[model samples]
Target: MAGRILVLNTGSSSIKYELVDVTTRDRPARGLVERIGEDMGRLTHRAGDGPPYTRERPVPGHGEGLEAMMEAFAAAGPELAPVAVGHRVVHGGTRFTEPVLVDDEVIAAIEELAPLAPLHNPVNLTGIEVARKAFPGVPQVAVFDTAFHRTLPPEAYTYAVPREWGVRRFGFHGTSCAYVSRRAAALLGRDLAELNLIVLHLGNGASATAIAGGRSIDTSMGMTPLEGLVMGTRSGDVDPALAGYLARVDGLDAQQVEHALTHRGGLLALTGTRDMREVRARDDDTACLALDIYTRRIRKYVGAYYALLGRVGAIVFTGGVGEHDAATRAASLARLERLGITVDPALNQMDTTGERAISPSSAEVPVLVIPTDEEWEIARQTHALIS
Candidate 1:
């Protein structure tokens, strides 16, 4: 359980990996392979913080990407030898509530859940397959993003649609939620089972989850990652009839509408750019409106999740935007002083980092900024299961 674990998070066009020293809770080495299958690609390997070992060429596939990573590790320092390899498989549906060792059956099970996470599970399974071949006898574990949300109650997970569709709310970002919610309790010096929290994971893919007694009760995402908060390239929670309407008026099929909503919507649709930092930099009306819409959506969720939890101990902010964007942190929770939730202007705007309270000292509900580490959590789980 104390040995090193290699964590791989394979995206559609990228492969991110970390060689974690679980005993120390520190990463010995980490790297990323970007633009995979393209005419050209880039690989960055960071070992001891001297300078990242870099490579650029035409990487053909995920298998090639894995090969490049191994080469980078060999050329760089910290020889890559892991007791177990952990993969970030995005969807586990209702079948896998915890990390499991990848076997032939597990591969087939993950493949069967591909419709639930078409963009994620396929590539995740590819990573598992390649790693299994590369490592030979090493253990490969699939740590699901949906695993932590398996605790969602029936009322929260149920949709009123039809029984034949077999569709319901299956939240994403539960891995990040699992790590941060427990970290939040540790930061607050309270028992996790006694705390009620609202965790906002504001990354390119964002979600807001309500955790009571360390279990996910309700989450912003439903059925897919596309149903959560407005993400960088994803439009979250549009009219349910949008696809049908587009099909009628524009001659666009449901698939076209779905593709547009997933890739061409959100901040990109409004301001012509998906990055929040770019929008925040410009003072134009378009950017201002985009920010307003984004923050307002978050505010609404805060209110809704707050109601769901009745009385909350803390409202946690994690992920890239939540951890660094002070303006977002303030704007998202603005005018919530009535609920005894208020961020201190000084603390909120500080250039500091790490897990710290941004709420006013006397505020009833603490607003905290805790950076998430899904890789570490995955590595720990992998090590645990391997041991």
Candidate 2:
């Protein structure tokens, strides 16, 4: 608590670390270790008010990646002693509702939930284990991406699946949604309990959650991150029978189909690229279709959640695509005039720097674009746990 809090977000093949001074809200250092287990791994480390230090070397595993991160801090600047380490673990299943100090039981629970998040949890566990080893005395807290959504009502979380499969909607982007929703309410000068919010988190992996009175009442994703709006590469929603159909026709197994849906579908399947910026730049029919599919899916969720919320006070956009892509934002909410949602062309197209509303002057619902701060939230939580 007396020192900095280091937050680690371990993705499938990347490690994102941030060292924050919780007392001052100052990030003394931050970096990313990308392309792990590859021939050439890259690390970009930066300390406060300094040029970033860059390195390209072979990082064979998450442990090596973390060691390189430590080296970066040693060589660059900021002393690498953290009082606590916060990890962004992707799945908590039904056990974790808040950040918990990692122990063997917590590790076992995370491992048990790996089947639900095959792409994230295992790698996240690797980071936790490695960090535990590297800083044996430091308190390491596991902050779940699904934890905030634990407040989801039964109706919203329950899937219409066979009860025996033990499957249900476990929404992602909860941390981002939590931070933005709070910020949106504060910006509007309204209490979160009195507001109905539609939160669209459109990063590489996208989701739409309907928050009623600061709690998730409904969300777009179900069971896995693959069941929501169109994302960078993952297919958001598809027919359940498609897997069986593919198996019958193309000899694809369930896992193979799941992999395709998780990695090869969505924008990549529709167009030649996964980035929305790339898709927006093309004038070809393929890119046009991809954009349509992406925005249309968002529109559908907006409509569905609007009906669910009955009276929505605000529509918030966060994450990479939501914050940056003006065209996608405009197109996604284009036909919601009846819902009193409209974006001003001037404001929407302008290159605004930080959190700001983009709705039309007379629009009933405030359409806001709040840049998410998940790392800050993770750091805060980690600091709180240690203190």
Candidate 3:
């Protein structure tokens, strides 16, 4: 656990990996196997600062994808032996509250929870199974994205429905939240217990989490990732009765409605493109409305979380869109001066980098941009568990 820990984030069709030396927080090697099961797949491995070693081939499955990773490390330079292999499992569903060493029981549990995260847990298990086989004796650990949100109080996680149905909010993007919130406390020079934070993890999949005393008190994502903020392709916060309505009128079942909302809704359904940059690039009315809808949802969440926490020490933004989209950072918090939360236009729009505040110096609340690193968080957790 003290040595190199290989972090594998297995997606539906891609496997993202990075080798972290827990002692130094450095990635001696990193790579991705994308377009798996497709006619052609690509693996790009970076060992050092020099040019990356790239390969193009057919990666039929996760097993072949991992084998391709081994091939990359073997040919590119860094000997691919890891002290432990850490995996990113998307959902814990109250069954797992922390990182667990992978075993047959763990694998079965992950498989069982696939009903909660049909698209993620299965592939995550595949990575664990393949890594166990690939490394033979190396320890395999699963660091769930939902584990960090286990601290949610009963009220925060409970749903107002039939108790026999058995459902509650299980927030996602917890790995990112765990890392960036700690970094936020460090940047503010305050103990995490003393800070109340609202973390907006806006990426392809977005969520807003309220963290008090370094614990998740509430989150936007509910029983599934589809219930939160509008994402790249997901329509968040839809009417609960839509499924029944569609079934009655259009002869569409619940599955069809879910499929459309999960894959074809959001920006894609609104603006013909899922990319925020594309919507931001155009001045057309359609694009303008899309941006407004997106940013407006974020502002609503911020206001709600602020009311929930009563006092927010900082608003942290992380993930691909959150960290890079200056326009979003500004628009989301627009017209909130009454709340003593205001972004410094110059500072917010500046071409700066790394953990930094964008709020006006005199503002009561600070807005920050802290890029998330889930790979390192998994490696850190894995190291701690095995150490």
| CA lDDT of every candidate | 0.91, 0.90, 0.91
Candidate 1 residue pairs in backbone clash: none
TM-scores for candidates 1 onward, in order: 0.96, 0.97, 0.96
The number of clashing residue pairs in each candidate reads 0, 0, 0
Count clashing pairs, candidate 2. Answer: 0
lDDT per residue (tens digit) for residues 137-212 in model 2: 8899999999888988888888788899887888988888889999999999999999999999998889999999
**How much lDDT does candidate 2 score?**
0.90
Tens digit of per-residue lDDT, candidate 3, span 259-378? 899889999999998888888889999998988999999999999999999999999999888998999989999998888899998988888779999997778998999989899999
Superposed model 2: Cα runs more than 4 Å off:
37-39
Off by over 4 Å in 1: 35-40, 58-61
**Tens-digit lDDT track of model 1 for 1-387:** 677899999976789999998888778899999999889999999996769999999989888898899899889978777889999999999899999999999999999998777778998998999899888998999999999999999999999998998899999997799899999999999999999999999987889999999999999998878896888888999999999888899999977887898888988999998888998999999999989989999999999999999999999999889999999999999999898889999999999888899987888999999999888889888888888
Candidate 3, run of 10 with poorest lDDT: 114-123
